[model samples]
Target: MKTAAIRALPASATVFPILFMISTVHLLNDSMQSTVTALFPVLRESQHLSYGQIGLIAFMMNITASFLQPLVGWFADKKPRPYILPIGVCFTLLGVVMLALAPSFAMILLSVTAIGVGSAVFHPESSRVAYLAAGSNRGLAQSIFQVGGNIGSSLGPVMTALIFIPLGQKGVLLFVIAAVAGIVLQTVVARWYAAVGAAPKPKKAVAHDEKSALKLSAGKVRMSVGILILLVFSKHVYLSSFTSFYSLYLIDDFGVGKQQAQWYLFAFLVASAAGTFIGGPLADRFGRRNIIWLSILGTAPFSIALPYADPFWSAVLCICAGFVLSSAFSIIVVYAQELLPGKIGLVSGLFFGLAFGLGGLGSALLGEIADHTSISTVMHICAYLPLLGIFTLLLPKDAELRGR
Candidate 1:
């Protein structure tokens, strides 16, 4: 029941600026990726991407982020992670610059790959740092951290549109400005971080016996991790696929206009933003096991509910469903980190990585279903994966979920 504060993860003032820098960078990278979704016709027609290829490019960052995030997290535990934040920003900046200047498909893919890899590198370290800065109020702090990403996703379309306005002159200049700002921020932050004797680590509630508890085999942890991966996959499909396409789907299928259809996305994100705060406390009070199981199971009825509703009410269904899907996100990371208290970085990365990287692949497949089948069909099919996560988590919670 004891909840004591950990030593400051960064300089007291530094935490806010670091979070600010990281959040802003996230905004830019996300805004830039909307390039594929918003400019689909232009990019697809000119470059001749297959339906699969287009989705792949859209989620390249997810795939790479999935693959590399755990390794980055693992290393962060052993060595200095201060530099990883701005370094991730640098990757996005470079990648975006390449995208703006891309002359061929190969170059475009390469640039997109950089963006993916870069995002992966930043997540574990950033999440860990965010965890520390949060101190005793993990739930509240993490929700704010998550909201930054939500804000970024929302900005994606808006920023893309703004940049697209002055396509030739302003777009190019805006990108240059983004890259330079990132580089400068990285430089300043790294210098400040270098003065530490020990690297950053979150303050644990109690120093649980590290060696005895770590005896849980990697195999067992991986299985739990695997279940989490399934959970995240479903999550990605619901968010990446549904969130990205519902506006279009509502318009195309329901004979709604783009402006009216956007209302669905707005409502859905609002619900989801609420869900993040809701899920965290539920996990802290009840167990992550029960909450996740119920949340995933809830997806089935909600998914089925959405397509059947009359147009007017369908937006309501999608909004509620989006919230159900999003509710688990931050809760899942907190759960995973608690389980593998042994490998916070690795756990953090894997929590985000599969969600980003492998989940990136899943997102595209969802997109393909959209391209060929129907968006509703894709959503319905994707809903089942969360139900599968129940088995993965059945073994028992790997870590405690005590709130201070």
Candidate 2:
């Protein structure tokens, strides 16, 4: 019925309104997710938790978020489910309530898992919706969609420091308001999606472009994807260091107050949001590979220099790193879509899932390292991860594609 409903409607010219609505939903949803990490300091002090325990919370949440995305995308690709968008937000709403009221660590873990499920459900379908609404400007549409999440992530720490820190765990319940907003927004978007016309058809086994230029065999295709995955790992693991622990790093290393540290985090994430908005347009103009190269590899010097800077200088370095590093992921997603041509959902899910999984694992492992060693040491270690972006050399040049 949903598929038929979509099929009956005509394709939209652009549907910027729907795209913006979906992006707003992404913002609300991710702000709630970012709250988990944002409250680390408060949670640690309140519960007498260790850094490892804090990381474990992130691990539990992100592992579930990451693991199920591919399956969700795979299912959505085969059978479109527009209504699931609001249903997914319901999971997040319930999780928010659970986190607010939970008494034990076990309950917190369960709460995070519920939230993770919502995120896993939300990403692929919403991404497909953005593609449907993209018209001819796929890059701009993707950037607009992604920038919402980055902005939400940027806002989370500030909100946490202001609300959650003073009001205690109960302050988290305030986010239920955002969850409700997400549900209402997503429901409307889902209805619009159901009326957006037929979904993009999936290519059979191989992209036609794969056959024409440079003649990539199955092995080469796999190799190329593997390289992209490695790049994702390098980018995400390094990002995890900041997203999961940067505040703690500031508090411990520089003797910065928790609220001040959050401000620094806000600065970095705002820069990330700006970078995300810029990447897609640049990629659309110059080619995706160029953006990928600059975003992932170009940030290395600042990343390496960040650990050694004073607090003010460190903040500046973080902004610079965030600006450059945050640009690649959206471009990566569009590039992968172009690579496979038809399996948008599957590709979005795979990359998003891997990012979450790596982030979770990296957070957990890095948390343990911080517990055993020092936060400063973790910073220095993560500083060099961006250097691995040199591997981008392995990717095929964008100009070589015979057909886009």
Candidate 3:
């Protein structure tokens, strides 16, 4: 019988090749997404747009992804479609082409929505792939997967400085190559996923995990999830301030040129990428709860000081804040997954969706604040957001999670 054959096949081991391939695709996917943010200054100048408009653009893209990712993940949990990987990249490809030629603000929104659709399909599915390929090293696997995204995100500032400033909105066309590469790489990954799917899942193990997950009362689980969501909201809203407005702040307050300002943002993002890479391994060695606690709370001092620092010190503070703050996200995702075992796709999708949604919402609100007040005020307000890390204390300890 097919079941007998599937059972006869050995259990899957850590699949590094698949993980790397998926990580590369994530880099490509996120780099393409980052192009939208990178285009902000060019668009603002060319269209004579306001801060609120800029925030709307970011919201359009990110909110679309936020709304759709959970659905994509839920569907995948029920019935995964391997070919969806390449299909998702096709959407991004179309978005890239449309973005390059978009003449009106409306067209830009439509184009970003397409890119958002692509991202929605890509993240949950690819995260599931990372989970499948992870075997026992889930933390390391997630870190590898997440570091690519942080690195890719860091490229936005670089692109703004190097490419978009010179090429204008048309520069977006260049990233079509990243989309094509993503498609090819995703195809390879899809095949491996398909092969993996042919193996029968360990239902008994899954049942055990499900039972273990339920050991906490429903109320306890709900409370835990609520706390995690709060943690995510706090982390992402703070990050949104940096991503959406930090460059403009530098330009307006510090007298830096727009292009020069991007370099500062780049430093912060690059530091974030480094932090993301280390956070997972550290969580694997230390407790996830400990790392999450340290990562989010530890950034408070630097973030609190950043608003008052001079240019040189501002950059240092931003870098420090970014490095420390970025470490918690991957660990948070991993912790959430452990909390609700067997719903990997759903949990990943929910957290990732919250991240994008909350960040987008924060950006939109903060942009309005910036338009009404000064960017400096925005920075000072966001500086205190990290203090919300105190809530992490409410989370159940790592040993409790493992024991359950």
Task: Evaluate model 3: give its lDDT.
Answer: 0.88
My TM-score estimates for the predictions, one after another, are 0.79, 0.94, 0.96
lDDT of 1 at 311: 76
Per-residue lDDT tens digits for candidate 1, residues 254-301, read 887554555566667667767765776676677677777777767667
Write down the lDDT of every candidate, Cα atoms only.
0.63, 0.86, 0.88
Model 3 segments more than 4 A misplaced? 1-12, 197-200
| Model 3 C-alpha lDDT per residue in residues 179-278, reported as the tens digit of each score | 9999999998887778785244688978877877766777877888998898899899999899889998998899999999999999999999999989
- Highest lDDT: give the candidate number: 3
Q: Which candidate do you rate higher for lDDT, 1 or 2?
A: 2
- For model 1, which pairs clash? 61-116, 62-356, 62-357, 63-357, 66-353, 66-357
Cα miss at 160, model 3 (Å)? 1.0
Candidate 1 lowest-lDDT run of ten:
1-10
Candidates 1 and 3 compared by lDDT, better number: 3
lDDT of 2 by residue, 146-180 (tens): 99999999997798679888888878899989999
